[model samples]
Target chain A: MLPTQLSALLADPAPGVPEALDLVSSFDQGLVDGLARVSPSAFGGLVDAFAGSPLRDRVAEAADKIAAGSISDEHLFVLAGARSALFGAVHDALLGQADAALGRTRASWPGGSGDAATAANLLAGSRSWLRELAITGWRGVDHDLVTAAGQTIEAALAEPRLRRLATLLDGLAAELRACSPIATMDRLPVRRWGDLWSRAMLLAQDGGRLTPSEPVTGRLLVLGADVHEHATAVQIQVHGILETPGTAPRLVRTSVAAPKVDTIVGPAVWRLFAAHPVLLGALAERLTLDVTDLPLLDSGDLLWSDARAKAGPPADPFATARVLLAGAAAPAVPPLERHPARISEPVFVEGYTAVDGAFTLGDRTIAVDTTRLPSCGPLTPQLVAASHACIGLLRWDDGGWSLQPIAVLTMVKRQPVGVHTTDWALGPTDPKVVKAAAAAGDAVAVLRERAGRLLRK
Target chain B: MDVERRSVAPIIPPVKPRKLAKVPFVELADGRLQGVVSSGSDVERVYVSSIGAGSHGLSCSTNNNRPCGGLRGSYPCKHLQALLDEAVLQYGADRVARYLRIDVEEGRSLTAGLRAHHEPSPAATVFSSFLRHLAYLELPDTTAPVPELHWFPSVGAAH
Candidate 1:
């Protein structure tokens, strides 16, 4: 049962208000109850701070009796507000003098539990601060409250555990250090499974002029764990290119580019090469082993390469293919095939340490050996791969990181480009001149010149 | 077991091809199999030769702050070494090392397992800074907190 003055103070919501007016409001009932409930009997240690204090008379008077049964919102507000005021002062004390204020906050109270009393006192200032920040957004807020809170902790010596408790609360309240007022939390990234994060940062090296050959210079943000304990996880996302407001760009429809080298090769050929990855590695000139993973950009016809229920690969494509189960290799692939499969030449780029095998194209073994690809700078494996992928991932509609194989039969039928032999295929740019001519939108000249370069190179 | 002798079985310890991804910086430049790992970050750059039957593999730590504890001379410690060991079971030794740049040797070498945690090198600092740049941007560009191993391109240094 709060008296009328406190009740009246709580009822008013607006107009020129005093600093203490915030203490006794509808906003903090717990604060008021906590302050009013403080008792020295509950806490044993320090009996000095309030023994002759001015607050003693007020507590004594409030203890006489409950004049009314129902506790009005206004009454609760006053009690809360008063508690808030005390806590605010205590808060200021702690900020001004940490150790001294700690002692006073622990001093024994005449009422209830010492812990409860401490919590109540702290809650007073805490609630006030919360309201002040909430109501005025901390503008014109008193720094004195924080200082006053520090003064109440005078009894921390023998009751050391109490100090720890007080510190714990304070720490939680302000655990995150503020570098900037705008910065509120320190985020630590956590993932259920270990995986590398991929980020794309676009920076120019030469000039604003996009390379005529490598229009897209995509970089690989490769994050992998050290060992088997760490299965290399990969993620790719687009960065830099932002949509501009107004002036909608004209839409163009085109087929998606198969992953990096989505060359179309027959299934039988693909299997033959898969078994002989070293052979393809040799042909691709990668010189790799089995564990190396490759992305495939497939011809659209083979919508689902792996006939499995799930999108991922099957446990064993070879054995499962004949099992009539999903993800088994299709009948198109066999143990051995007269026709060897083929992948794009870019597979010979740097990090591609493995390939199926070298295929004989005329007197030359058309194995694009990446045996000498550098690993750093502008033309290293990383650099070349980045450049190729960048172009693949960003070139018009047929851009992205993908690796798929299509049947040679399908490629011949579609005739995206000329394929004289089943052994090799060519893109818009193969021989240098053809690539150059193609860039100029002159496909016929480029193709003819590229065919000659192919013979020469 | 290529029972037929053509060797199509993908034998348990398949024949390993040369791992070009193992940046041959120290080995190629100074022609040294031995190198120092100043920061735990450069562990992955190490290339261990003669792993299984003369085939090589690499190992690196994912735990950057933990100091990638059990490395012999290579960057990744024993824990990561074991993880790579199984990679041979999946991707075959040579090809896997090429993609990951980390290898799993068939047989463990007592000498290759030495810890290079203490010794510092300028190349290592450069490698560490490289990693820091990636991390500071909070961009997931490279593998996370690569362990005791450091990667330096063999040719990049030469150039």
Candidate 2:
């Protein structure tokens, strides 16, 4: 229902200047509040209705002065209606500019045919659309849309015909600011942004060991591995994830360097993997070699050649050398006992019994000669298995007495587990040594190819 | 809205090298020779041209180092000469020559849009050179002023 004074004015349709100003004065908050609700066509009609009216011109002038801070303590009720009417003028000017440019180009120019419709239609949307976009920004940032609109308007401003669009955009920016309590239209609360990553969990460490929890899922995007190094260790800090799309993406990490993994995989290898995670992932997918055999440094010449053929040049030549040297077979040399030195004094050496021999000590059955003294008895396979130790005179050492311990020498016996490269048993389980080297080689090859492509272009 | 694409045509002629001083000359990628030469006013005119797509205008103004048409060649136009020298060195003589040929073949347009920016100075020269380089990079700007200058793999070395 219209106000009684406004209904009276509408019935007459063409009020005198004094009467028109009095009728507009009746609306204070209502005029400013309803500005966003008016339809573009209806706003256009109002602009046309007040065309060349001195009262309308005075109102627009007074609004401008208020904005410029030249007028203060003025009657805002009249000014608010003027501001609402001012939006109508802005709408008309923008439409005219777009129409003029479209007519000139016939909808084809720098961006070509399809873009003509997009550019014009975006500007032609209702004034309410801009307000709606501002409101959206208030709740949560739609940065891509905001940036596109801003850029489109900026580009339009360069064209002489579309110059007025800038003024309209400035006004819309103000309206958007008004829609929000926050001073900046783009600033938004964290929880308001839907689909943006808002939660994080870190791996915990206990007793010098890294304890891993389950990886976070759902709305997952990218996981960035940041590699940093100290003197003795290299750390791989995973830098969370990017959860939302924007012109300028903002990555939110709730924790700083959390759930870190430390490895002595060498700086070169870590650097290679960390520098180009995407390239490494791509290469890993394409690789036909066993992941267990990765970082193929310890492999012989045959494996090296095969890796080079598959992955291109090694990324870090030094790391490759270290792997190769560490993996090479031992040099061919006889034991020290076989060497011709003077008949040495009695030497004591520790060893496991290999075969049946005389002289059983404890539960050990040592295989060595003890027939020279009565302390030993004849050795048999059963007795030797039962015996734990024995003494013998070694012929290999010029009759020096030797003692052998039959400590459990079974192949099934357990050995200490460690990350040490020299630990033979580790070869089957831990794969860091191999993966690091292979990744380094692949990274070098990929980076070189990328650089080459860019240079040629 | 009634607008049409501006038509473009070549308006300026090749530079007159003789009007220039007997200074050392460096030939640019676009078939134009840049050198310090004396004009009829006895001032040394820095002879620079936007040669490819034809000459954008070849009247030698004094280089940035000196007042316009000053007498001394001692203050050579470093901006024009240095940038050209660097370009020639970085992108070999053959590549630059190839670029020149491409520009020459693509005759200049006379359209208002094709008209060189009003501030026709060393700054403009650098900007035009940059645009040509972007074309070399295969940037997708069909509306770029000098599309003919765009690099093509088959177009000699610069391509």
Candidate 3:
């Protein structure tokens, strides 16, 4: 049904050479149908031309009709492929502009169910500016397109309930916001990229370094581009040090490209964290929790430590761990261990309070002597609750009875380090305590020394 | 005893003992507990004491963002108070010879049901940056917008 000139243009392998105004100005549904039935190869060029224009709606409409018909799977495949490459971007840019020009619009379209006529008219009317940006990647031409997309996204974000708008816009806003032109990096397995991401993270720190003392298998030394940028975009190199059983630690070199909008690092990273949180888990010492709800990091904020004095302190592992546990159903924990002797006559001591170097329990006011460990002097709420709930090991002397709480036990649910298992266990035991204690001194010194040696070389 | 004197072996200065993977805690003469707490990226020397000899009624050297309430003549602040509580748990009631009576009596009720507050360690800092970057570079095909709860807020003065 398309005219001969339009049909000829659709079949051209290397496109964009058509008499631009004549071909686009007279676009119609028959032309799209002809292209779908005949020259599917030219689909990509079609998208590039009309992506942010009024013709996008018509393309969507035609594609929908074709999809509903007895169209061959091959034609359908070509159409599907071109939607992402062309229609999706143009649709986003157009809607972005429309929403901004109209101001605080309602979530009416709901993705596949927009008022076709209105959307078509709005987009068609905006063609003057879109036509210029259609073919060229020049900066200023697409300003309204990009800005509108950004603004709509920001508005939707301001009120979380507006996510219904996401489905309405055919998810164009999101696509536009997170859109990147790089080749897919996710095609690579997590294990490969995980090492690169971890190493780059460590390297980003001031003297950032990690060498798990335990000899890990598949000790990979990766040299890749920065995780945030595409391999082809920029050329910042990073190295990964893999410790093999017999071989010297291998140094793998890597590089990373910068993001399109440097400001996008936070949202992009946050989304990634949401999708594959195990990536973060791989780096935790004792546990790793979901950190997607954390605030966005500023440009270069991720490089700073949680203990930074001025601003943008690092994310609190303990708080993150606690919040993660609180969000889910509390896992079944090991039953509280009870003293064998006191099981039958478990003393329900009431109104216990801290006294001078001792504790007074029950109406009798019996003083439980305190410990010699200076670290053990202060009484905490958990210690109090445990004392009330469970009968502890007690020693009776000339002064009276004394109880020493065995341990500060709380059931902590988290994914264990290295094993990738999520389970709940009574924590602050010897292992966690030891890990925390060692982190401040021995672990720091060891890593620092190793780094110093590496620097010396 | 002059049996062909076994050649006195030369003493190689004991291989500078490979720095222990675990830092050793030193006990001061006054019964304070000093040790390096290492949880991966965080490494620092922490000192714990039972008696508050300083003007503040506490002798801990750990850094805290909030002022010590115990220093203000109120109940021991969460920082010093946590130290005392940890000391009791670290060393059983038998060995610790001294403790503040006010905390034993009043501190229990005041801090009851509250989770013990811990100072952020250097290791925690390392993990934050590591995890952040790891998530940034590698998650594939993120064109779809994530739910709002998953997005983290930028750090502001709220903390």
Candidate 4:
């Protein structure tokens, strides 16, 4: 019930503010006259403006299966996820009228207002051309929104309102040349590694049980590992969270594996948990565990085989990530219902701050993405400018929304460190992880003595 | 909300490779110059070239589009001169000679300001963006926030 030029660009004196570059050239001529009234011969007037809409019977059953050319690839991924949820509800109602007209032109324009920085760079090139027209009408169904709408159309063609809307930036440079993976790898949605191991064995036989199963103590923490390798196996994974005194923190992971040696390249998950000393003493006694019977896999994976451990009481993983980012929420599932190749979404943040490489917090910011930690290690921009709780995987690279941290929590000399107990992911038996693994020379003790002579031949 | 701690830097600054194993990926991006080279007689091949700014339009193929028989004629191959020598060692020679509108002079060298031509172009979206940047090192470390990584770009056009 909006679209009267986006309800006069979301009302309240925003019908083109203090002539903000004539309201950013009438929002680049109303998004190139709303992409020539949603062409394809005005798509039956946008499916009769979605009649009696709840996306009008899935936009009239995806316009009668694209007028009967017999659709299917699961109705072309439900008609490109219902035309990207109807152009993401008009790109989230023009990002609430371009973040309230760039927060009222940065709180009442004035000083050095080159027309309020060219009307806030033409309202950020009309919000990267309405977010690349709602991610090119969503074909290429989310590979992290086609890599953040091709880095928001390469930072919206470095806008100085690049000649207003040159054919809507040449159809966002031909939808960033049909976002390659050989052009949307046959429009995704095939997903089969035996349907992700039969949806992880039907999410581990229906909701991997736990309710009052007795033996459920906690305090695990850890949160970092990730190694990978593959073509035959090297895996690693690890990750953590547990914290069960008065419940609510869960997300776990485990993995490990090994074998794939083709000349041991990039090893490090603390040199394969230092050549598996019984999986590094069951991950150093499940990082100070007070656990029993772990198994639980309703996707928060964790099964450390017939687990049962003791040593607890000493948890300060940044005060359990400030009681799990003050009781998290706002996730109610949906990352393609949790994980069909889950393209990044784990968070945690805590008292942000950091600065330049970015983090900030209250007034938002974020940025940090050290290329989503390629085989972890360097989180440095001087250790995220001396942290105070980070824990990573926010995603979308280069053109913004960063945070690939992994584990942080700071303090050091005044004690409380925890980048999984320093020397990045523990082990070398402390004395400050054997003086930071002998000043980074004992390359994980020569790759754990060549992976313990190739796992004892 | 005093938040300042300063440090900024990143309007562009993100090229840094210098060699990157014979053009493992170059950039300039979309307006073109592009990347993903590799193949000198296949160490498991790669190609995905590009050029295009100011109709210098060329391409080289292989991430399945095939082509690249040393992309003949209007010169420039040897994997597009090793992706213009690793995009002049990750964007330098006067910003890849002003993003391929090549002018070069002072201590000239962005391939001595050449003019390439062959106009082919698709190499599966710059080798599907170098295999989605090598599938972000096979993911799974976890903490989870990928709601399309909060569709970034437009912090009021950054600076």
Candidate 5:
């Protein structure tokens, strides 16, 4: 149970993270029991204490609405919203502290010294944890848990071994005055794969600009293609990186829409393309073209038009592509601007092991988000194990960073081989595609046959 | 390029299935082990059950507030047991045990440590969550863009 002193602190007009933490930590089983039995209206002042918070108003309105009635769905949602807002405020404050500490440590140690690097890595880890807490709205957290987290950060800030890193410990005393919460009520609505794809399509529609018709030529390396099965259409989006010498590589994509058909089964990538000869040829030309001035959208979408094409020197583009990808730096995006299925930045990640459905890069393990992938045909453990690197989008979704691999690179008999992970959806003629399809078994043929018989009737 | 030339070693082994649907929704939130459980007899019926973690104050009632007959007993009802089992499945056994503040040595079961008595908690909140979960299935498979997703970083020049 909260001591009288701590309980008194809860009445403060604006409580800082420290005060909030203390109040939450003081909640024992008996205190929590008491809280559950009481009406939400009894704690209306607590809600009002977060002055100017939109959630506070909403919660107040909800409490009043339910004052003379039984609890309803709105009450539950409002309660969750209130909890999220309160917890989010605290997490955001902690993140600000961590960010400030990082800035100080970096400033003091300009040189890439060992201590500086270790401190930076530790701070980065701490930031990641705090960011995740903010994303999850600190759900299921209790007082003891919050205290342990606070103490750990406190100790890290005061550690004598890293004196330079510890300089920001005094800043921790600064009161977090703002209680504004990023409204999370919208997140309560469960979203599915279709919803995400629709969102991507919507974003793709607006604010796109066409490049000058004067034509800029570059070597286009077709990385891969993803086939999306929607209700009305089978949409195939092909991805590639355009390299103009002395310019930064630009990620580009093109889409092909085909009528929905039920006869094609078992890995639509191979079956669909195999049946569509003309579409297959166009895809082949895109892959074979050495240089082309394709009309392009600023969003990296390629537009079909009177584009020039030429065959240049026969050399592997994968090596140069890897070198370009290594130097690519993604622009920093704030947390609020991130979401699931949003491809904020496209880059290549090399030197990682795929294990346990995640990629281990150095000391950090990022889960492989298959949902964002256009298609999962070539992402089998066998292919992943053989690959040395992958090119994909860096996305912040489900409360953390995930990579959606579009292409995979491997060494076969000492030759660097790059295959579009989505190309398995292309023509089954490709030996790699044939091999993958074979491994998937005769189920494909059986399904195709069944589908064919059904169509014939 | 043919990847078959090289010997393919399996990287990710098949995952062990931890099906958590014995009880549809269980969460450690609001200082309680609470969720809505499907009725054993009626497919359409559900009971909202919650046990305050350390207080062991139990509540089992239908969405409309009718108390369960099982609440008369000192021990948790079958629905609560199912909730605990699913909670262990959702969050690991250790986390569930720790949240409930129950003492259990290594390899001992969590339910063995639980104790409960009747103390009715409002069932509306958990029932609402279950309804929301069901609502996801009713949503149409749509190709049209969703307005709610606009907050995501724009992939175009607008950003």
Candidate 6:
């Protein structure tokens, strides 16, 4: 109901133009509050609809302009609609009770508040509610109060602002109508989007953690280590057979879908299996680096040496400064104690692991989860073979580290340009880390070679 | 969407030290360096390029002291817009938009997207000395003037 109407109901009612406006405002506020209160179910649609809305700034500006006379009040209805939405949201979130006055018998009680903070629980509850409610679309929020408030604004059919607000709200409501009511309630008693994330279950391909790092030759630097591929594997967990306890568990695997290229350009995806609303909104801010910058601060030609792969491996990481100082006289130092580092060929296909900080292949650093590690000392036979396709190898030189990129077989370039040299561990998954770095390095070598040949000719 | 990816044709005429009078060094967007000098008799122009993509633009008074924090020079930056607006006021918006459409929302700026790209100005010199080094390329369009700048984005756009 409009504020004036609310005021009237609270005391002696008045009938006038100002009163009518006040009544509209009061109703608008209540509706917005109600919408907010019943979010996830009744109000979430409005919030989602507003999140990255292209017309958001425009709508807001139009409203402000009309209110301030900077522009015509043609936008008054739009403003009123938005205002009412806000008020409805708050009401649905805090005050709206889910008690059905009429006698009823149902067992959909997944009650309480504190548990809202646990996303797993929230997600489970949401899923259950959807299944039980058979919710094919956004569910209706049965807030008598909000319904009444909406009516008050609707009653003022002549008010253009109020009418506009109703039109937009209708659209928002349509989207909201698809969710389950109880599941809609985020952390609030009814529903409030601010607490929405605590109860949502994110999806994979939506994101990933920092994958391990790999060394790459300068030749592999052509594509830079920013390249990556996202995939999902179905995990099967089968236990007792439905027919008998003796039956072996048949593997039941679940496969998630893949994301698109736009989704590929985010660190959030690099850190988690899924993306959140806020993070998705921030996607536009993320940067997709081109492999071109690796050449700066480089220490020189190990990457472009034509005979690298065919030639012997780099000087052993264990080689002492005294030995390195000896130069060529010292036959290629044998892979030494601590293996000082692990290395990768520019076009190597296998993922690799490093011991103690001796990251080889073109990488100086690699982020790995100790738990996900294949084994302790050096690299396990499995890891070595798996990580054999190195982007580059790390060769010890005067106690300093340098990378050589393995040419990516994909690119026809003879030599790669550079290597990624960052120290941040984006995450700790195997494919996430090693494979990601490998893919990036793979592309790098291809590009670097192309650029090198381009410059050469 | 039709970002002209034409190869850098090796058509530049060699400059003779005897005839090539160098320009005085001056500050540029990137602190590294740049300078401008007149070369050809008729036009006084310069090819503003940078080593890092992030620093490729003329150093306007405002950004002179600021390092351009861009992947390859902040495209559609205020400095670029200012320059374009000035150009629009001088040369006319229609012409500027016609020859080099500046698409702001799509991340295109006249200076960054339209101006010629070259290596970082390691040292400042009269930009006019290498005027021919620059080439104008088209950029995508901004949000507001979508349809006006040739609709059909779906026809092609890498993004």
Q: Pick the candidate with the highest lDDT.
A: 5
Error of 5 at A440 (Å): 14
Error of 6 at A37 (Å): 20
Error of 2 at A10 (Å): 78
Docking class of 4: incorrect
- The per-model DockQ list reads 0.03, 0.01, 0.01, 0.02, 0.03, 0.01
Ranked candidates, highest lDDT first? 5, 4, 3, 2, 6, 1
Q: Which portions of model 1 miss their true places by more than 4 Å?
A: A1-457, B1-123, B126-159
* Poorest 10 consecutive residues by lDDT, candidate 6 chain A: A232-241
lDDT by residue (tens digit), candidate 2, B1-159? 000100111111111111011222233322332332223333323333232223323323443422334212322233333433443443343334343333322443222112122223352343233233222122111110111110000001011
| Cα error, candidate 3, residue B98 (Å) | 69
As for candidate 1, its interface RMSD to one decimal place is 25.9
lDDT per model vs. reference: 0.21, 0.25, 0.26, 0.43, 0.44, 0.23
- Ten-residue segment with the worst summed lDDT in candidate 2 chain A? A198-207
User: Which of the CAPRI classes, incorrect, acceptable, medium or high, describes model 1?
Assistant: incorrect
- TM-scores, each model vs. reference: 0.16, 0.16, 0.17, 0.28, 0.38, 0.16
Error of 4 at B70 (Å): 25
Where does candidate 3 stray beyond 4 Å?
A: A1-144, A163-457, B1-159
The single-chain TM-score for chain B of candidate 3 is 0.28
Q: Which stretches of candidate 4 lie over 4 Å from their true place?
A: A1-218, A221-241, A252-457, B1-26, B29-144, B149-159
Residue runs of model 2 more than 4 Å from their true location after superposition: A1-117, A120-457, B1-77, B89-92, B101-159
Alpha-carbon shift of residue A105 in model 1 (angstroms) = 92
Best by TM-score: 5
Candidate 6: stretches off by over 4 Å: A1-245, A248-251, A254-457, B1-159
Docking class for model 5 is: incorrect
Evaluation by lDDT, superior candidate among 5 and 6 = 5
lDDT, candidate 5, A248-367, per-residue tens: 765555554432222123344344334344334444433434446665543345553323554444333355355554443222212221223334344456777778667776555666
- CAPRI verdict on model 2? incorrect
**Model 1 lDDT per residue over B30-139, tens place:** 11122222222443323122222122333332222223346455454544444344334333544333333333456854324333233322333323322322221221
